[model samples]
Target: MCDAAETRPGIDPDRLSFTIALQTAADQIVNASNITGSDRGIAKAVLADPLPARRPRISARKVKCPMSRYGTTPHETRPLTSRSLTHLDITVLAAAEQPAVLPPSPANTDRRSRVFRLLAAADPGQDWTARQIADALEIGHLRSLSAQMGQWITQKFLVREGRGRYRLHPQWAKTPGDSLDSTTTIPA
Candidate 1:
């Protein structure tokens, strides 16, 4: 049975089954009343000898990163440098002092503006749901959406395709200068 290990080239010396068997057999006689201390010491020495060929070596490499402060408010600590600095926190800004100017005709305004952009991007006669517009424009209030959307419908810039769906009036899509923003005009 033990000669099996002689055929295996990479046999483990610490195999639990073999080690436990050898330890159990040796513990009985090695610590027996008849065995002398010198005999026990010799047995222990033979069992404790390390059987491995050599120890493994280790290697390492260095890494570098920009020495910058993380988690510090950039405005408070770092100078603004990148093109990504264009995002302004408009939430805290004051409302405009003057009343917003309405478009020259009842046909153009914010609601119409948003609708025109959305409809212009859709298929020539494709219907779009109000829900789709709300999501696209990030509209939160239904009343505002209704009022805004109603302005476009009333102005004939957009037409209901049915089931609360709408499409840009074909003529409105073709018109080059039919802008919807109030008090805003393209230079050309």
Candidate 2:
């Protein structure tokens, strides 16, 4: 029931608005119906049947751990000073700290990278098989690697000495692409 005594006698808009709102909220709670479903449903859930949830006795700072975030045992790191170290361990650690120079593009994206790595690993004047290149690079698509050889063929980047074998063309590597121009990136 609206507080009629609280309502002003004449042309009282504010009390009427409050009366309407109180009735709307109570009506929604009884139906468990989301009238306008914004904050109303949450308020309905709370007020309709006010029940307490069982929460564990825990604090934020105490729960802040790497294992807690990942929920894994293996990832839990020990304090650095607690561990014992050897001379080789120190050397390996120092070497690991130095950043490795990665190849320019994404490692497994382009076939050119896999081909280059395979060629670099091969002996001075020896040719590498398409399967061998695929195996060496741990790449699944041997056909794509074979297709890359064809690209090298069209570009004249390497001499495809027939039947899937490619040898580095010394002349192509040495010659610059641009005519009398500087700041041009020549093909490697």
Per-model TM values vs. the true structure: 0.34, 0.33
Error of 1 at 45 (Å): 99
The residue-by-residue lDDT of candidate 1 on 1-188, one tens digit each, is 13333334444333324554456457767667435443443234334443554343232211133453222322343333333455676667777799888758553445556566666765666788888888887878867776766676777767878868778777766355454354544121
- Candidate 2 off by > 4 Å: 1-109, 172-188
Off by over 4 Å in 1: 1-109, 174-188
Return the TM-score for candidate 2, rounded to 2 decimals.
Answer: 0.33
Write one digit per residue (lDDT tens) for candidate 2, span 1-188. 12331232332122234444567668777987765656544333334332243343232223346664323234345442333444553344444566888869633345564455446445537776778778877889778778877878788766776687776555433233322122323365
Q: List, in order, the clash count of every candidate structure.
A: 0, 0
Return the top candidate by lDDT: 1
Give the worst 10-residue stretch by lDDT in candidate 1.
56-65
Q: What are the lDDT scores of the predictions, listed in order?
A: 0.55, 0.52
